[model samples]
Target chain A: MDQALPELNNPPKTRRGARTVRKLLDAAQEEFGSKGFHEASVAGITSAAGTAQGTFYIYFASKEELFRTLVFDLGRRLRDFLTENVDETTDRLTAEAQGMEAFIRFVRLYPDLYRIVLEAQFVDPEAFRLYFQDFGAAYRARCEAAATRGEIRVQDADAESWALMGISLFLGLRYGIWEAERDPGPVVASVMDMIANGLKPRPGEGGTA
Target chain B: MDQALPELNNPPKTRRGARTVRKLLDAAQEEFGSKGFHEASVAGITSAAGTAQGTFYIYFASKEELFRTLVFDLGRRLRDFLTENVDETTDRLTAEAQGMEAFIRFVRLYPDLYRIVLEAQFVDPEAFRLYFQDFGAAYRARCEAAATRGEIRVQDADAESWALMGISLFLGLRYGIWEAERDPGPVVASVMDMIANGLKPRPGEGGTA
Candidate 1:
């Protein structure tokens, strides 16, 4: 956090400054969501937030910086939501059910932010690359820990984590938000069932649970 | 397909016209891949293709139209690549392995067009939606047919097709295209295995071999 940076002169410790920051973030979210990263402007965000252009600059450096912050904030919320809502049980079926439920809730709650993050992946490849790399690495570590405890048999924990993440993102996009014309729950369940069962391999290669 | 005002007034049956069109398509692929749909301009593409700007519009209605053609062209090629390269077998595991292998090879070969399509989904939502709707519906029908023949058990074939599409796209982006590179083959195999086995609900749930 840039604590030393002041609003023109000194650090903005006043109530007005804090309010301004919140409004800017709220505004940025709307602009970025609706207009996209390349098309969005600082002026548009500031106007939406009901602040002057100068005030916008005083709080954030540029449109890119603000959008980056917005992505970071949204990513945090998604991670937290997934972690908090799902039960910590190691059972695959229970975990799948709870995980899918929480993810569905999150997708329904913040559809635009979800789209923004996904769009950002294409609109701004550099940023998307950085975020996913960090996300994948962090996620892989957690999955590896679980696999170590025999919670899951991950032939390659990193690859499994990436695939699981792929399942989460694509299922959410195709059903929940992308078209906004379909119910995603049933589909979510089917895929979840697939994940729960393990895609059928050779006969007699099945696991005993 | 539309021949009313062939961009190349001269018949592409002529070797020169064929060469020009090929050059233009190649140029559009390069520019669109690097700059995306919105950023790349007609002039840039034409310049890259070593053709005049008027000639660019002469062959295509606009940059978007050219990009659309490129997408259609590339997508068809990808489909062809998948079918041709993936050696089919009666068994599920062999089919999956071959499919993943072909997919990995395709990504490595045409990363540019791959990113363009992926980015188009985000950059131009309406265009992608309209374009993919029919494509998705057709793909869903194929899956449904496969399920009917007892090749796979799918509750919602459309959703499963979409899920598979999503999985493949994300896997390509994360493993092959995105930064901090990792080999895509092993990752693809691992995920495909998980999709085939890890997600199955129970014995006999997937259907008898």
Candidate 2:
């Protein structure tokens, strides 16, 4: 979490500076969300922010760094939501549905930011790689713990981690983003149910369903 | 599937034009793979091909057109691979594995083109929407046939189609390209197994390896 950059200097001494920083970040979210890392220009962010060119450089070192900040902010929010939404009292199916709901909300709220982050996998993979590993590690730890408690099978912790993350992502990317118009709730429910209790037939229950 | 683009007009007097086109596509594959769609320029592709800028324009109208050509080429290959690999003799497991194999091989073969197609999802969604839809339709049709034959349970057809595609994509993006040095065969097999038979426990089988 430690960084070399000056950390906002604790709540911007001037109201104007605070407004400028907020504007720049908001502009950055839109620019980076739409244009991605390389195509998004410094001028684009500054112009959208309604700030001078010099003012833009004062807050962030480069467009890449600014985009990183925006993406990291979004990632942190998703992680926070995931952590806070954990319901220890519920069964696996119910808990998973809640988790899906939380994730769907996050995706719907920031579709552009979500695309930016997802697209970063192809754009500047190194940035996302470092961040993904850190984020994936935390997610894996939670899933492994749940498995340890006999909630799920402790089969290949890392593989399970990948699958869980992959499933959640695919469902979101395909239905939530690609379709855009389709309501993601029912699809989310179907996927979560599939993950919790898989597609295979159960004893005494025919495979009709 | 018909298009209005010029194709082999007046027939090539010599292999010279064919050779030039091949070099251009190869150059595009490299440039688009490494830098992605928006970041990759016409100059870059042409320069890589050792041809002039004018020649590049002669073959493709714009970068989007060039990208669509690449996607169509890859899609055709993937479609062929899927069809050739899956037959009545192939069970659910083999078919899934072959599909995964085809996906991994395609990524390895055209890493840059792969990035371009993926990056297009964020960079130019409208321009490339139909390309993805066409490919998705092809894949869904295959999955649908497999389901109707009672090979697998008829789950959400759309979700299953997209999930399989997304899993292959995110896995290749995350593991195939990003990871330092990973043999994707085993991981791909694990995912195929997961997809063919979901993660629920069988009645008689225990967690012991």
lDDT per residue, candidate 2, A1-209, as tens digits? 22122244243567677778878777877888776677789898899988999987777777766776666666776777777885846644466667766776677777877877876676556667766787779766766665555555435556556766766776676666666677777777656555655544445554334
Cα RMSD over interface residues, candidate 1: 7.5
Predicted model with the maximum lDDT: 1
Model 1 residue B158 CA deviation in Å:
2.7
Candidate topping DockQ: 2
Q: What class would a CAPRI assessor give candidate 1's docking? A: acceptable
**How many angstroms is residue B202 displaced in model 1 relative to the true structure, after the best TM-score fit?**
10
Tens-digit per-residue lDDT, B1-209, candidate 2: 22112243332345676677767777887888776776789999999999999887777778877777776666666666667755636755467667776666666665666676766676567645766678778767766676555555535666666666666766766665666267767776666555555554445554321
Off by over 4 Å in 1: A1-12, A90-92, A179-182, A201-209, B1-15, B130-142, B145-151, B179-183, B199-209
Worst 10 residues of 1 chain A by lDDT: A1-10
Off by over 4 Å in 2: A1-19, A84-93, A201-208, B1-15, B82-88, B201-209
Say which docking band candidate 2 falls in: acceptable
Residue-level lDDT of model 1, residues A1-209, one tens digit each, is 22222222233578778767767777777788777777888888888888899887776777777777777777777777878877766555567567766776687778868867877766666767777777889877766665555555555667777777776776676555664565656777777656655434234332211
State each model's CA lDDT, in order.
0.67, 0.66
